[model samples]
Target chain A: MTNASAQAASPPWDDVSITVIRRDMLRFARMQLRDSGAAEDMVQEALMAAMTSAKSFAGRSAFKTWMFAILRNKIVDHIRASSREICGADLAGSSDMDAGLEEFDVLFNRRGLWNPDDRPATWADPEASFEQDAFWTVFDLCMNKLPEHIARVYTMRELLELDTAEICAELGITRSNCFVILHRARLGLRECLENRWFQGEAR
Target chain B: MKMMNCKDATQLMSERYERTLSLRELLSLKVHTAMCKGCSNYGQHLDVLRQASARLRAGNTSGEP
Candidate 1:
């Protein structure tokens, strides 16, 4: 049998387990970093880490979730290292306060909330006309408008699925400060999306 | 019953809406939302945003473009 055929003939999960998982990791990385290049790098590093530590996989959580946790850590580490120069400065000192005000607290406290079952009904279903492409376009635009640090933190915590404690540790932020940043990020995005897309809709 | 202010509602929205809040925060938000139209509406708005974001992510993953 051909190598490809042999692999295909195996169980589906066994045949493409790595690919499927890697894609998930990439998707998550993309969400967290919001930068394609950075997300790719983070995924590569995470996969390498996961493979090297395969023996440590105790099956405590689903493989995907465990892998995601590792990926999140890697992304956090990358963000911290790259932005080390600004670590000591006051977080609120920057002119990005407007952006910070909306996203800081909301994004910071967004852990343990990923399950579909947990989402509110109002958010459970989206409008039929809400194409993902258009939503992402607006989303990206709004994200791009954020100041770099605030955006980065929001991306890490919200998109990447890093827990607040992990983020605080990685970024050297206090819990209160993390919450503040997340709150600002969400508020800013809400306003941006409302004005840009949902203006006519009763808000 | 008093309406929850933007400050308090904003703080509780993500967690309460996501059902991730601690008992104290959850109860507080529940009590606040029970009487607060503004806060309840704000929570609904957050739900809209989350759904929108998820849809966007799903679309991206599916290669709809």
Candidate 2:
């Protein structure tokens, strides 16, 4: 073994506290479930699972990473169970965030060229805005404003950092369609941020 | 390969996050962004948006909305 690997201390997973991460876990669950009651149940189950499997944790990852991994697996299962009950109806409709197409039309013509007027102007002081808490608030609001299904897809792909195949299997979307949905989500988010945060108050 | 316009370039820019681009797509995006100021500006906006998203998540772990 290398000297660095031998010297590196393993995190004390045994003393890890679940209470500390409870709120963050709940917030993440609520974002995915949009239902507080279900979110609570999921969090409870995740904590229980973590406790049971604490001995199995080899400390290769941080305590928080291990905990959240359990929580995310619970979420994936929850999404799967809920979609199953709906008989593929919701998952079938998952990929259709095409309502944002009109916004795309405003930016691009039938020939796929960006409209001259719609070209983004130089954003004023964008880097500085990242330091402001209020900017993140507006950014959060804009993200929440995305259509429910599309927002979920974006959340799964971007926030959860799930791979495309996992997302496709969980959401029942084909790869090509999944890419289109994510693209539209980014476009919609970009426009919303432009209107509400970037150009709105930054100017 | 079709002539990439500003619209296609912007879409490709976003897709770069989710998947690998074809060589043709990359070359097209390169040529298009090289000449199109609008697409280039959009690309920069995307970079800021990505950074903002990362910062937002970082703050979230501390329990802020």
Candidate 3:
């Protein structure tokens, strides 16, 4: 809705060609799976499956959205299959990222007051950034940089919009533990965002 | 309620979203943040993160603008 972006358009999806779609799909899969080869294979698999179910293209969603849905399901299926094999390990040890605790520690001093250097600064016009693609790129990177277990809990609570009780049940964690994890997640994420994105602004 | 340190105050700030704080916890947090600009700004940053993630929940994977 910003005049600049409205006039310019974005993501350069104007091509909207299969090549473009495939590339975009691969990018998303790579981010989610964090494995280049695996992402490539999943996108290939999704493309093939989409061709077969082309008839199911009831025009309910955009082509990219439909394709993404297929790709996401494939990724989920892959995770489910793999996690089934490693189920015990995953349940027994979705450990808190110790580095996150260190990050939390640095935020305050021995006196339990904010460290002058690590103290939170007011972000400049943060809500205005929600509509910006470049901002999301920074956001995604900050998200991905989180330790896997932290990222997992954060994705469940924030992206999936799950309630804390539901998240605790799913993770087999106590309510208090879930609260701590969520708090640590917000702390780490906000710090990362500040360093990566807001730090660049002339404040 | 005992006074909350910045670390505990920030953690409580996060929990405030997931659950209602007891009156004591809420009052201590209120008293601390009322006097501490750093914790107050930290609370605002947490709100920004919440809003940003909500966009992802709305199905915008990339390129929100």
Better of 1 and 2 by DockQ: 2
Of models 1 and 3, which has the larger TM-score? 3
Put down candidate 2 lDDT per residue, A122-195, tens digits, no spaces. Answer: 78887677666576666667777777777788877765667889887776778887787777777777877887
* Candidate 1 lDDT by residue in tens digits, A87-140: 555343444334446433442234422123222222223463254445556666
Give candidate 3 misplaced runs (Cα > 4 Å).
A1-33, A36-87, A94-100, B59-65
Estimate how well candidate 3 is docked, as a DockQ score.
0.52
**Segments in model 1 whose C-alpha atoms lie over 4 Å from true places:** A1-6, A9-77, A80-130, A200-203, B1-3, B15-28, B48-65
Deviation of model 2 at B18, angstroms: 3.2
The CAPRI class of candidate 2 is: acceptable
Candidate 3 C-alpha error for residue A67, in Å: 7.4
The predicted structure with the larger lDDT, 1 or 2, is 2
Q: Candidate 1, TM-score vs. the true structure?
A: 0.58
Query: Which sequence of candidate numbers ranks them by DockQ, best first?
Result: 3, 2, 1
Model 2, residue A18: C-alpha shift (Å): 6.6
Worst 10-residue lDDT window for candidate 2 chain B reads B56-65
* Residue A117 Cα positional deviation in candidate 1, in Å, after optimal superposition: 32
Return the TM-score for chain B, candidate 1: 0.68
* Top lDDT hit: 3
TM per candidate, chain B: 0.68, 0.85, 0.84
